[model samples]
Target chain A: MINKTVATLEESVAGIFDGATVMIGGFGTAGQPAELIDALIHQGARDLTIVNNNAGNGDIGLAALLKAGRVRKIICSFPRQSDSHVFDSLYRAGQIELELVPQGNLAVRIQAAGAGLGAIFTPTGFGTLLAEGKETRHIDGKDYVLEYPIKADFALIKAHKGDRWGNLTYRKAARNFGPIMAMAADCTIAQVNQIVSLGELDPESVVTPGIFVQRLVRIQHQPAASAA
Target chain B: MNKWNRDQIAQKVALDIPEGAYVNLGIGLPTRVANFLPPDREIILHSENGILGMGPAPLPADIDPDLINAGKEPVTLQPGGCYFHHGDSFAMMRGGHLDICVLGAFQVSRRGDLANWHTGAPDAIPAVGGAMDLAIGAKKVYVMMDFLTKTGDCKLVDTCEYPLTGIGCVDRLYTDLAIIDIHQGQLLVRELADGLTFDDLQRLTGVTLTYQPAH
Candidate 1:
């Protein structure tokens, strides 16, 4: 059923409980919900475990959440070459937990959760230090390694265009984790630049259908300097 | 010794590839090496989208609409190639199963530090992708990059200018001018790509390149 579109970011992101397992879309700040993130920060939601492809850059994207000391743990596939001062500080202080997976594994793990798969095996980190301590299983006389699934309580995404009913369209690399995270999250919220009526979006262009999305908020752009 | 250009450097690197190895060719210039792998070699090409035994870029008429690489470029699979679930393909990557991962580098430090993720911009996307995983995960990490960025700053440095994808993960640095290896905390100048001298390499590199042909 098409639901009421909320008026403001805070209202849309309200009830985003503390310690929510939030799966944020975007590969390195692309296609991230800037408005929802700001709302989450302003709301002071703490102890979040964000499953993101990339944790934004500097103070611009999800990295801001880390900088704000809002997140509790991070489960991800990509670890930045450039270390965030906030992340390093948090890590050194043991204030937060970090689990790093391979990029490919990151994508597959979330998909596995959405598909209800418990685990799968591959040859990724076989002989290296990565294989140490992990259960190594053999199938058909071949060495296969086991990797588990990752899921989340909320999925926050940025869409180039969306409908009040929650259908979404993402542009370019921005589409990276949004669709899959939408499927894996319990409550999916989309912060969009353009909100249109149903049937306005081309079926081919709709990456995440409305069925997966629960809330939609339209974001009005504010200049970078004025953004919190 | 010959004066090697980008193509020659690509061929030299391709020549070093052992038979039956599983290799991932990175984007841009490194992608060209797909043409140089010996056809008779029993190699398996792995693509991130879950294809194995990939042949090379396909002919226009032979293009299968369904076939492509991770970069979204059209490609061809070998005669016996198979396509599996994309999840399965990544399992091969993160599981540390690949023989080699050929990648492009923005910067490589002298101590074999790899920084190929993002330039330092506040809003710039932070972090490296599968590149980091492949860097540490692959048995061998081969970095393919020009010796110098457009600003004439050498990409290989004492400390990386960009973000680091992996700590001490790079094994070999293949360039248009020379090939370098990291050993005992020193940048060992292995072999010049061809016609390029140690001094020429030093002139281009910001970091010191130690030459010990006898050692």
Candidate 2:
């Protein structure tokens, strides 16, 4: 009776509106939910503000989404990479906006959103150019910069396994931002390799609890191109 | 002067790391340090993406798309390794849980300010991943880079002209020509490449240098 598994990828991404702030989990392509992103592309939500570690790699997934011209802004720590040509061009042509935060700040800010903290004082960017124009505080002899939480309307993540209850477990380094993003978003949509039966996943090992995830879709296979 | 090659510099950095040290190697040159780490030492490598106890690059047959380093390259997880989320991963760096972090830099001021993330070029797309956190968070920040730019300008400067990654965070600097330590705003020469004199090192560096070899 507590099923959250959706029938189709379209249904999983349904109800996402234009101008929504979306968090896509991944550090590069490791945990990127390519299938869910492809579905979102088809869903046709425009002017999205995306939050991720990198913009995209090569001409697929987040890059394909960016190439679709649906994103208006990207809030990420690093958007420039050797294969990030799509974001690079879009950024240079003044087609999209970028808010570059330090990697730790990005993670903690998202964590802060989920944890419901008003603001945090982190020493990661203290006294650096990134700290310029931001609030600063001296705490116990060390300078700290004030950063706010980054809450998203939706979070699209990939996991190794999940149940109908939406409890999830991630594999290896692919777990990157999935767990925290699931908590920081209003609606967390997850794509998993398999949907195990109830109580199949060990309660102790469940990374993202059912309380955080809203929808789950089992991706039977990864697209060959995206897998590489 | 018999300048040390990149691998030698990396090997030197590896030699400095003690056993049981937890180290994070930045992408590119810093990653080379891993190859030269003493076989006897049990050094745990941390990747900012969400892996601890990271191993070297995997063989082509062992490549797993899901398991990659911060550079997005396929890597192996060492025994006793663990996977974590970005929140916990960054927390490890920002919480000073890391013993050492070696990073690549564009410029490092004599005061130990780091400038590697951005060149301040208006046209350049600035992407600063975990550089700032590693710069400020690690107990010892070791920078590995070329002593001079390709065009013959010193990278070690009196003051960083580009956008800073972190201020006064670097402890030791390992360059091709010499190894220097930043202590209380003094650039103390630790070791120089064979046949490289103190004056020769000073002539190449933009900042003043003091000869104080490590014991």
Candidate 3:
């Protein structure tokens, strides 16, 4: 059995280079691989393209990463919020680039990459600016716009529990984008709260099978702090 | 004339939602409908961020950092509520599993064209999220917005000049001044705020509206 565990967060993110396209798994601060992101910020990887649900909720976690001035581009669904001052400034100054994908399209495009599909036509953005320059076809008398797979070089994810083999389960809504992002990346590093011995995680309960995971690191919990 | 306030508009939208309906409420004004839904009715609310069976907003202390709505505000889930991945949730949306979707709009054409996401303003930030999906995916789309912009321009237009979110998708238009239905390529005035006359609505709307009296 391949032992995929890494001893430290820095070791887990060791291979990430500048200009890497990284997929981050989280909705707001929940299910974010915070320690790993901090490690990357410390590692000083620059000109990176990040994919996530939102730009970053507050001035911590992924948002902190953006504020660090390391990201070159962001591809996400919702980018601006009240707490996203870091992104707001960077975006307005043209210091960063944004690929604003519709939320469902963002999900399925990642799913498509994992499933080995080339492109999928969705009716979500048919008549909007989102459909501009995309191939449109009328199927069954309904219009759909073509969207391609969104594959990433690396995926950083947080999971509630993981076994030695890397089979994972999530807590509540924390599972939002982790499973799909895990499958959509070339190398997936998971930060889990706990790691159980093999066979500890029920096969039926595993949300992300170990096959999609490449490495794992454990994250110690701290008292919940005020959100950024 | 006494026009409906924000909550009043939300209450009117809630009255049209039937029991046991699975509805997705857009952010902003449409989110207010959740507060006005009849308590006896078992309407399953959905948030596009992957939560189904969504309940009202949570108090400050009851806030769970993990649970949030499409608007990214903390929310509570109903007893049987569950969450899923964004892909599955969107499949439920694009596959037409939702009973209705109430959304806020910048403009809704008489032909039911929806243009809510962007205004084409040079300085305006574009955030289109799931509006496009919900606009076209839900079984029916009910729009809730002020009848006119803060600048006092009527939003109910003959044609949408802004970029459209969906083509011919709006089924009903609920505004502060009136509740109108789109039928047979015509705008039918169903209910009007008290102290407003048909001619008043017509002059305010800047469009032709047919009044259908209740039986």
Docking class of 1: incorrect
Instruction: Write the number of the candidate with greater lDDT, choosing between 1 and 3.
Output: 3
For model 1, how does the per-residue alpha-carbon lDDT over B53-133 read when each residue is reduced to its tens digit?
877767887754346665546677778887554355666766678898888888888877787766766544243456655
Quick one: ranking by DockQ, best first? 2, 3, 1
Candidate number achieving the greatest DockQ relative to the actual structure: 2
How high is the TM-score of chain A in model 2?
0.98
Task: Provide DockQ values for all models, in the order shown.
Answer: 0.15, 0.89, 0.68
What lDDT is reached at residue B98 by model 2? 99
Candidate 3: residue pairs that collide: none
Question: Per-residue CA lDDT of candidate 1, range A1-228, in tens?
Answer: 666478998888888888889988755444567668878888888999988755545665677788888898888655442535666666667787877665666777788787788996754444333445788787886555688878888888876688877888865334656777777788888888788988999987677788888988888883252122
lDDT of each: 0.72, 0.94, 0.88
Worst 10 residues of 1 chain A by lDDT: A122-131
Per-residue error at B31 for model 3, in Å?
A: 1.2
Tens-place lDDT digits, model 2, residues A1-228: 999999899999999999999999998898999999999999999999999999999999999999999999999999999999999999989999999999999999999999999999999988877888999989999999999999999999999999999999999999999999999999999999999999999999999999999999999776575456
Per-residue lDDT tens digits for candidate 3, residues A91-141, read 999999999998889999999999999999999889788889999999999
Ranking by TM-score: 2, 3, 1
Q: lDDT at B35 for candidate 3? A: 83
Ten residues in sequence with the least summed lDDT for candidate 2 chain A = A219-228
Q: Model 2, residue A93: what's the lDDT?
A: 93
- Best of the two (2, 3) by DockQ: 2
